[model samples]
Target: MAAPVPPPTEPDASARICPGDQIGPCAACHRPTHKYGRGARSPLCEYCDAKAVERLGRKLRAD
Candidate 1:
């Protein structure tokens, strides 16, 4: 009988780090992202991050 095949492995987390730009995954969408401005520690991609901020602003204004 033939042996079963092993499952494919995911790349190491370190491998996903962009070497030249030091970019990594977005915190919200998990897409690759890079630092933009003063909020360097944020891992969110621009669109999701903007949406998050907008949602917060709406909540604050509603209160």
Candidate 2:
């Protein structure tokens, strides 16, 4: 048997505005950054993402 085809869908507005590899601000901090894949208007920069992970670890430990 063959697999059924998936239905088409409209493209996201953000994806149209900011395609993959486009520079955008970090979600946590207002810092210009890239490397966020497609339509990421507010993606976290490396530093912030690392800090968030650290914070999460601490929070988990405290609990």
Candidate 3:
């Protein structure tokens, strides 16, 4: 009688953080960011996005 061979084992890959989309530069700050949908314009970085909101508030107050 012949014995069966065991399957090869591999290290766990789930622990690794992988981005499904490509990482590109942020439009406003040029920092590394995960790109969104295809054909979509680049988005602002975190700091720029927050600053935009603050600027909008200041503009409204000035009106």
TM-score on alpha carbons, each prediction: 0.45, 0.47, 0.48
Candidate 2 pairs with clashing backbones: none
lDDT of 1 by residue, 3-59 (tens): 442222332234256463656556666556665434456465555556777778645
Q: Rank the candidates by lDDT, best first.
A: 2, 1, 3
Supply the global lDDT for candidate 2: 0.52
Candidate 1 — what's its lDDT?
Answer: 0.51
The lDDT per prediction is 0.51, 0.52, 0.48
Highest TM-score model number: 3
TM-score of 3: 0.48
- Candidate 3 lDDT over residue span 12-48, tens digit each: 1221232545555667656555455555466654455
RMSD of each: 11.9, 12.7, 18.1
Question: Candidate 3: lDDT over CA atoms?
Answer: 0.48
Clashes of each: 0, 0, 0
